[model samples]
Target chain A: MVTEIFFKEFHTPNNGIFLRIKDSLIKTRSKFQEIWVVETEGFGKMLLLDGKVMLTEEDEHIYHEMITHPGLSLLPEGMRVLVIGGGDGGTVREVLKHNPASVTLVEIDELVIEVSKKFFPSLAGSFNDPRVKIIIGDGVKFVKEAKDSGFDAIVIDSTDPEGPALALFSMEFYRAAKKILTQNSFIVTQSESPFYNKQFIVELLKNLKSEFRYVKNYIASVPTYPAIWSFTYASDSLELDVPPKRKISPTKYYHPNMGLDTTKEIVDEVFGCS
Target chain B: MVTEIFFKEFHTPNNGIFLRIKDSLIKTRSKFQEIWVVETEGFGKMLLLDGKVMLTEEDEHIYHEMITHPGLSLLPEGMRVLVIGGGDGGTVREVLKHNPASVTLVEIDELVIEVSKKFFPSLAGSFNDPRVKIIIGDGVKFVKEAKDSGFDAIVIDSTDPEGPALALFSMEFYRAAKKILTQNSFIVTQSESPFYNKQFIVELLKNLKSEFRYVKNYIASVPTYPAIWSFTYASDSLELDVPPKRKISPTKYYHPNMGLDTTKEIVDEVFGCS
Candidate 1:
């Protein structure tokens, strides 16, 4: 890795934005399919893969908040949680904050995890905890075995709905997801932006609604993500919302008082939930 | 103008992001320090200046919808409208959909309009309507001449708080805006994204609240914007949440049915509006 890359400011109507790509790299690694830890102005340590901003190092708060808080806070305390395809350990780190009994992260790619450990020590720290189990295997198979064992909440933090990750979004995978959860359990997945992929999100929502009794979609501002983002939460037991039961702690982007009630509002607008 | 500037793309997660800088070939004429357009995949065009994305190309529907509908819809039948700084013409386009008696668009940067006319025909076509007026001047000065002329709605579609356009976000400018409207009239401005610029939006909201009793904030999804954007709607007689009476035509966005209610909800959330 002997490459050198730099940032150039762009014309924006919002805030300071930057782009991080590989030029000539002196220090770079092949993790996941195309993962890179990017640093930007105002926002810090962002993760990028295939030139997409995966998670910002500075403001993982929004992603983590929307992902972890909505599901964990709604479930009973000390529930079992499983996260699929989160190699950066950001999802697991957020899950740990909820004080879950056992948190397992099954990531198919090992190099991504190794890269995260090397470049992102803070987020990678969650993997070192005893309560957290790191499994290197196919997430689909892992979910099958884990389904028989029983779980409370499952969050899938996978990549895009293309490439090898395509199976993650299939109906078969969702069927497995349904069987893994215990009664009164909830499942959350990162749906793409409603702007560029409204039809895609609509189809994803359709599939999810077909399986779950309760389904909801919420939007969040992920500067790195396309067309902002729509996150989907589903369950047979409880309604998903933006209103939070507990106060958020140590976050850069999410506010605890904001709650998950907003989640319900967005979902209501999605398919005319009202 | 003879020479052209080029932007380079960088790879992130699953997107191609672009950045711009001052080039010897292309000359920038704006009084602002610098301007850039960050181009990213799936997300819309992002604008940056001095290293920040102030506005992006994509996901502008949200901001444009909120800015145009509430103010125009609130007017009496056939009320005239004057839009300052909406040279890209998206706001004017939305205003035209309302089938107002007449509309005017004032923009300073002919270059921006020209660029849009070339690169973005959709926004440029917003200027194609017969009833719409296109003016080239500083909006701060243009409103003073139109006082004797009554306008049902006046929209300030300009940049953020700093530069020659800084005054546009000020009380004095709003006072001019107030003078341009008829009785029971309204105005709207592009408030920044709450996720990224809460302080800036809050400060602007405070200033507007000080001048108008009916003041509120609304949100939209812009992919390239630093954060999903929020806008401020203000009126003299009617509460901001109350839908204005109107029969606007079809729009790519802003259906009067859901549009009106969506604005109200966004206002309720951002401004603590009742």
Candidate 2:
């Protein structure tokens, strides 16, 4: 008899993606969530948290570059950055490309970092740079207790809006994150899929609108994710629609011509705006 | 015991999407290929050909609008259009929105049209329009036999590049399509996924480039498809990079601001162009 092993993630109770795995590289329960590393024939190595795909080697550049470049591009050089819950270091890897003064990554789970360092060294290598500071703690608490007006930008690269990462999606968290940002600073977060998570995206955008002077939503296609993945950009004073401050080279997805603007029509349709 | 039913499509030998089905609406073998219509929990009614998803009720707007508007929006009003292999009438539905003088749709399978009339009335309703002409025949043969300089635009809304639809993606067919188009006319075709069908897209774009003076590629997110879906536009003299000739409204996905421009970076990466 032939044996079959597959990893599946359901975006809705009824819809999702499945991948045939060659072998399980690692499977263990972390302090915060269940973690699994699997090798696949098509996508190379994949990292999953709580059975949800976090990143795969083949398409991780699209997600990491998209999450970092749009926000960081508007800011001046040597900006101080904060990344919450990106234990795998892909966000930091992209941030470092912008010549940041510093990047402080606060991740609750240490095991994810260790696993990524072992399996995804190119991404985890960002931790070795002297400009990056790694913090193993609750991101929400760190933001609330941090000194005010310190960081220039905040990137919430957490998991989906559930489990320990649930607080990261709340308005209260957005307000707390705002307190630590210098004037003209921005906050960007993964706003989930527009197709499968419409309710979540609408609610999250509403919360961001309440907390910021300008709130915009942009999207990129991450094939491993549920659908077209969305991102929320919130800022107080930065001009949202302008060319990047400078060119950051060596990117596969996020180029200056790439359409990273907030698609207002999509927002209007989702919000039922006439 | 409770039983479960699923509709699954493998994008590759190892990866794909699956949706929970409430019930199979219809299953039949056409003269060309296998056809199945199943009621899905999240996606509503879905049509499958040869065990591959053709479209779903919930997100079909994205695919239909993207495939039609980008090219049609550039053409002048009262222009003639030809659509190859779009039996379901969704492409015709969008083409009519452009106020074309007339549309000629050549689809090989008559049953696909019959099924669409029964199951997807809104899409098939375009067939009732006096300006639209439906032809049940091979699209390749029809394009070959059609009078020269007849159509202002041609939309190839065919299945995957296999089985009965394989000829549609070939250069021989594209050369024949060009013969039927008026000068300054354009041709657009659904070119499959950028991630899953990279080889096919590269090959198709190369063929289009060989036949047309200018060829470009654009992409849109079709959640039910394998990944981010791609489309190719080929033309002789139409300026591809200007604002659409006119506003085609009441669209959920295609607006003037939507990034329909050929993303050269993606093409460069796929073609290994420096």
Worst 10 residues of 1 chain B by lDDT: B257-266
| iRMSD of prediction 2 | 2.3
In CAPRI terms, where does candidate 2 land?
medium
lDDT of 2 by residue, A139-258 (tens): 999999999998999999989888888999987899899999999899999888877677788788788878888877777888899888888899988755534676776777665555
* Per-residue lDDT of candidate 2, residues B1-274 (tens digit): 3227877888888889999989888998889878888888878899888888999998898889988988888888899999998888899999999899999999999999999898888889999999999999999999999999999999999998887789998889888988889897999999888777777877887888888887878878788888778889999888565356788877876656555543345667545552
RMSD to the hidden true structure, all candidates:
7.1, 2.3
Model 1 Cα lDDT, one tens digit per residue, B203-240: 78778888888776666556445455677788878765
The per-residue C-alpha lDDT of model 1 at residue B269 equals 44
Model 1 residue B146 CA deviation in Å: 4.6
Each prediction's number of clashing residue pairs: 58, 0
DockQ for each model: 0.14, 0.53
Candidate 2 lDDT at B209 equals 82
- For each candidate, what is the lDDT? 0.67, 0.85
